[model samples]
Target: MSNHELGTVQVYTGNGKGKTTASLGLALRALGHNFRVCVIQFMKGSSEYGEYKALEKFENATVHLMGRDTFVNKEAPEVEDVELAQEGYEKARESMISGKYDIVILDEVNVALDFHLIEVEQVLELMDIKPKNVELVLTGRNADKEVVKRADLVSEIKEVKHHFQKGIPSRKGVEH
Candidate 1:
């Protein structure tokens, strides 16, 4: 396959702060390769996150969030949450088919599934339907075992150290 035809789906998980960060790194890498990247921020609406703030300015990437753009309650996800998640999924699916983006990162997509905001089956279907040359990446904790099974690469970031434990709050340009 030509370099343009290289396509694979990656899953980044585990209890770590860098799941999304790693995905963003990949997105930047792809963009540097002259590949168009699309990032769908499921369950995230605010653009205050450092990556969002930086990536949103990139010419080759577009970021969109489906939910109300607030922190979620893992203990109490409502049906409306699922609906918004579906909307985000649809946007991802649409981007997958639009054939414009070379790489698509469904950031926090698995979290939506774990939270029952999106169906795992639907994600699988979308993955199956993607173009052969379109690369895909999914980021979030608790990514389904099925998803990990289907992915070409699955990396879990186990947290061994975090400054947050020492009471350093998240900051702009570093941990927004």
Candidate 2:
């Protein structure tokens, strides 16, 4: 079924492991119904991610990688990092306004904002201009308070326990 009728602002944020996973699950559900989905991943540039590889098979899904593989210096990000984030933000704006997507996911945008790679005002403006028929999903830790206040749904996935504490590295299929 076409999902042109869908619309809502959803946020997945917190210090948990499943924020991106949750959003990807939503994308999978939408794609199953033949909805057009756009994912703009901020602060993540690896093409080796499992979701990236998996989503490549969906004709209705588009994923944009917008950062270097190296971690951005939160206190003083590189010029390239800033540039990529801006590019990603512009792409997200275009996707939302183009009316070509049923769902748009800004993965890790909250962290982009937290790291000062993008301004919170710009994100707020994007929210203001979102078409009534477009569904927006923002995923990352440290979501801005204003964003949370404006969202139609906000899910905070707090980390109760994780294997990372045991010094286990990210697994291939599970984390990447």
Candidate 3:
């Protein structure tokens, strides 16, 4: 049940929800086995999320929020957005190289890449340098084909239906 073996690259991407949710679910499972986990959230720095608050209960987990509460324009991202994402990426890469965590989840990294905040080649290079036992997870919509091609496992969460279409806002403990 423990992930004590070689860690593989896992990607969760698509035009749907549950990408970050799925990665966090994995993090929770990893914690059950006493694994050290780091969650670096990109473009999602709001402290109001229930998950962010709940992460305090896990002693072996660390969550880094590197974004503002404001929305970022994908077509033309602001300078501050780019800077924040770059900082997040640097911290994420450092964490992975330090061998300080068993699982490193770069939440919303794919979106950052899609918005041109980071380059695909940069991520690809990081994959090459990752520690053998470090599990690297990238989550967000619009994942590059190159990323999918390099990952060991790729799960696309297709949007079959969503409450947002029904005018239901994000609820605490569920969508937040």
Model 1 regions more than 4 Å off:
1-3
Q: Flag regions of model 3 displaced more than 4 Å.
A: 1-3
Writing each residue's lDDT as its tens digit, candidate 3 over 121-152 gives 88898788888889999999999999999999
Question: Of the pair 1 and 2, which is ahead by lDDT?
Answer: 2
Can you give the TM-score per candidate against the true fold? 0.93, 0.97, 0.96
Best by lDDT: 2
Runs in model 2 lying further than 4 Å from the true structure: 4-6
lDDT of all the models against the reference? Answer: 0.87, 0.94, 0.91
Q: Which 10 consecutive positions of candidate 2 have the poorest summed lDDT?
A: 1-10
lDDT by residue (1-176, candidate 2, tens digit) is 36466488999999989999999999999999999999999998999999999999999999999999999999899999999999999999999999788899999999999999999999999899999888899999999999999999999999999998999998999887
Which model, 1 or 3, shows the larger TM-score?
A: 3
Instruction: State which candidate has the highest TM-score.
Output: 2
Worst 10 residues of 3 by lDDT: 1-10
lDDT of 1 by residue, 70-145 (tens): 6778789867777889999999999988988988899889999898887889889878998989988999999999
Please rank every candidate by lDDT, starting with the best: 2, 3, 1
